[model samples]
Target: MSGWVAVAGLGPGADELVTPEVMQALAEATDLIGYFPYVARVADRPGLVRHGSDNRVELERAAHALELAAAGKQVVVASSGDPGVFAMASALFEALEAGPAEWRLLDIRILPGITAMLAAAARAGSPLGHDFCAINLSDNLKPWALIERRLRLAAQADFAMAFYNPRSKARPEGFARALDILRQECGPDRLILFARAVSTPEEELRVVRLGDAGAEMADMRTMVILGSSHSRLIERPGSPILYTPRWTE
Candidate 1:
C-alpha cells in the first residue's frame, strides 16, 4: 500500500469538536503518533498501532511518522488543537525539510479542527469578534525577550489577543511576567480571560480585568485572551457576556 501522513487536530477536548475529515483520517490510520495524552484520546482498534511520546519530543515524533510513511505505513500525527497553531504541523514540516529528499514527495496532509482559542471564544461570547492575534506564550523554542517584544507590539496594535500554552510547571514565571507587561501596556481596566479545558467536562471560564488577573489563573490546559481597547462586557441576568464590538470609531 502507498504510504501517507496526516497531521490531524483532535480539537480542544470534546470528541464532537473533531472534524469529519480528521475522524476519517484517524479511522484509516495504520499508525498514530503524538504526545502521550493526545494519542490516548484515540480508541484502540484491531488494525491500528498507536505511538505515544513525551510532550517535548515533537520533532522526534514527526521524524518517526515520516520514517513510517516512507516504509508504506499510513501514519497520523495527532495534535490537541489546530495542527498549524502552536502544534505538530509546523514541526512535521520542519522535520520534512531536514529529512531525506524523498520524504518531500510523500502524501502529507494537514486536517484542521476547532482550535482552543476559537472554542473558548465561542463559549465566552465573541471576545475575538474583531481584529485579533494569537501568540504562544511558551518560550521553549523562542527567546523570552522576543515574546515580551511581541506582547508589547500586540498590545500597542490594540488587537484582541489569544495566548496558548500560557503557563506550565517548568516555566511558571513567564505568564506572570506576561500579566505584568499587559497590565503596564494595556492598563488595569483591560479585560482578560482564562478558559481552562475548554469544551470538556472540566471546562472553566473566567473573565477579569487586567489588574486583577493573575498567573495562577492559568495552567498548561488554560487558554488566555486579552481584549483590545474596543472590547467590552455586556451585563446579563447571570454572567456577563464579553465581546468586541465590530464598529471602530
Candidate 2:
C-alpha cells in the first residue's frame, strides 16, 4: 500500500471538539505519533501503533513520521491545537525540506482543528470578534527582545492579542516580563484574560485588569488574551461577557 502522512490537530482538549476530518485520518492511520499527552488522547486499536515522545523534539518527530510514511506506513502526527498554528505543520515541512529529496515526493496533508485561542475567545464571549493577532509567548526558538518588540507593537496597534505557551517551568520569568511590558504600553486599565485548560475538566477562566493580572495565572496549558483598548464587559447574571465593538472610529 502506498504510504502517506497526515499531520492533524486534535483541538484543545475535548474529544467532541476534534474535527471529523482529523477523526477519519486517525481511524485510517496505521501509526500515530506525537507528544505524550496528545498521543494519549487516541485510543489503542487492533491495527494501530502509537509512538509518543518528549517535548522540544519537534524536528525529530517530523523526521520519524516521514520515515514511517516512506516505508509504506500510513502515519498521523497529532498536535493539541491546529497543526498549522504554532504546532507540527511547520516542523513537518521543515523536516521534509532538509531531508532526502525523495521525501518531498511522498503524499503529505495537514488537517486543521479548533485552536486554543478561538476556544478561549468563545468562552469569554467575543473579545477577538474584531481584528486580533495570535502570538506564541515562548522564547524557546526566538529571542526575548523580539517578543518584547512584538508586544509593544501590538499594544500600539490596539489589537486584541491571544498568547500561547505563555509560561513554562524553564521560562518562568518571561510571562511576568510580558505583563510588565503590556502594563507599560497599554496601561493598567486594559483587560487581560487567563483561560486555563479550556474545554477540559481542569478548565478555568479569569478576567482581570492589567493592573491585577499576575504571571501565576498562566502556565503551559493556559491561553492568555489581552483585549484592545475599546473592549468592554457586559454585566450578566453569571460571568460577564467581554467583547470589542466591531466598528472603529
Candidate 3:
C-alpha cells in the first residue's frame, strides 16, 4: 500500500464549503484521524478506519497520523476551517520535526480550506477588505498577557482584526477582559461584529459598536471582527455593509 498523510481542512461548518482537494483526500483515505467533532463530519464507509480523539491532544494526534502513514496506511488528518489556521497542519509539522528522520520522507500534504474568518467576512460584507490580522484568543497554548499585548498593538496600528475561540465555558472571562482592552484603545464607537456559526443553519450575525458590545455576544463558534478606526458602514434601507477602504491616510 502506498503510504502518505494529508492534513486536510474541512472548511467552516457546511459540507459545500469543503474544498475538492480535501474531498478527494477524504475519499482515498484508509484511516481518518481528527478531533471527534470533525471526524464525525465524514460519512462512515467501508475500509475507512476513523480514529477520533480529544480536542486538546493535537500533537499526539499528529504523531499517530505519522505513525500510521509510516506503517503504510493512507491517513488523512482532518481539521475544521483551514488546517494551517490554529489547526492540525502546524501540529503535524511539529511532530514530523521531532520524530524519526524517516518520518520526514513520508508524503505529507497540507490542504487549504475556507477558514471561519473569511467565511464570516463574506457573510457580513467585507470586514477584512484591507489589512487585517487573525488572532486566536484562547490562551491554552500561550499567555493571556501576550494575547492582550497583541490586541493593544494591533489596535494601535489600526488593523482590522479577526478573533477566534473568543469565549468558552472553561475560560469565559478572557473575552470580557479582551473587550475592556479594546474599549480602552479603540474607544466606544469602534464597530465590532459577532458572527456565529458562519455558514450553518444556526448562523447569527450582529454588528455593534464597541461600547454596546458585550463579552457574552461571543462564544467558541463565533468569529469576532473589529473594524479599524477607518472602517465604515454603509447603512441602507435593509442590511448594512461594513468595509475598510484599501487606501488609508
Candidate 4:
C-alpha cells in the first residue's frame, strides 16, 4: 500500500481463482482500474476506489492507472483473465514507457492467474495432449498476415492451438479463414474445441472438426482449441477436460 501498483489477474469469476496474494493486494489497494464488467466482479469489497472504463478506452484507462500509481497511490490494475494474455498489463506498461520517468521509480508487479485457455482446456478433456500454442486472431492490433503466418506454422508443426479473440463484429469471417488454413496444414480430421464465456453463467463448450467450425459457433467471448495430430478424444462417464504436456512421456 505504499509505493507503485500491483497489476493482477482475477482469473475468471470463481472466488477460488483469486490467490491469497492477489486478495491481499486488492485489500491493500487504494485505487483499482479495469474494464467495467471486470471491475463489477469485485465491487462488494469495501474501501477500494475503482476507475471502470469501456473496452474502447484502453489508452485512457492505462493512462489513468499510471497517473494514480505515479501519484503514490496503491493501485491494482485488474484484468479478469491472466494479465499477460491479451490483458491490461501490457497496455499499462506501454503507456508508462511513452509517458514520463515518474513511473520508472514506482514498484510494478505482475501476478499470474488462470488464463481462459487453461480453463477451457481443463473443461474440454485433453484437447492439447502434446505440443501446443496460443494465437489471438483479432486483427484490431495485429494484422491478419501475422495471424495467418502463425496459424500456418502451428498447423504445420502439428501443435495444438488455443485461439483467443477468434472473432469480432467487424471480422466475422476471421475464424472461418483460420479454420481453412488450419485444415490445409493439419487436415480436416483435426478437432476444434470451442469454449465460450468459461467460468461464467453463460458458459458453453463444444468439440467439432476443423472443417465444421463456422460463424454460428464463435464470437468475441469464445476460446477455441484446435487439437494437434497427436491429440485424441477421451470418452468418460461425466464431463471432459483437455491436457497438453510440456514433454511426451
Report every candidate's CA lDDT: 0.95, 0.95, 0.95, 0.81
Q: So what's the TM-score on candidate 2?
A: 0.99
By summed lDDT, the worst window of 10 consecutive residues in model 2 runs over 240-249
For model 2, the local distance difference test gives 0.95
Clashes of 1: 0
Candidate 2 displacement at residue 234 in angstroms: 0.8
For model 3, the superposed segments whose C-alpha errors exceed 4 Å read none
TM-score for all models, in order of appearance: 0.98, 0.99, 0.98, 0.92
Q: In candidate 3, list every pair of residues with a backbone clash.
A: none
Better of 3 and 4 by lDDT: 3
TM-score of 4: 0.92
Please provide, for model 2 over 1-249, each residue's C-alpha lDDT reduced to its tens digit, 9 standing for 90 to 100.
Answer: 499999999999999999999999999999999999999999899999999999999999999999999999999999988999999999999999999999988999999999999999999989998989999999989999999999999999999999999999999999999999999999999998899999999999989999999999998999999999999999889899888899888
- The sequence of per-residue lDDT tens digits that candidate 1 reaches over residues 12-90 is 9998999999999999999999999999999999999999999899999999999999999999999998999999999
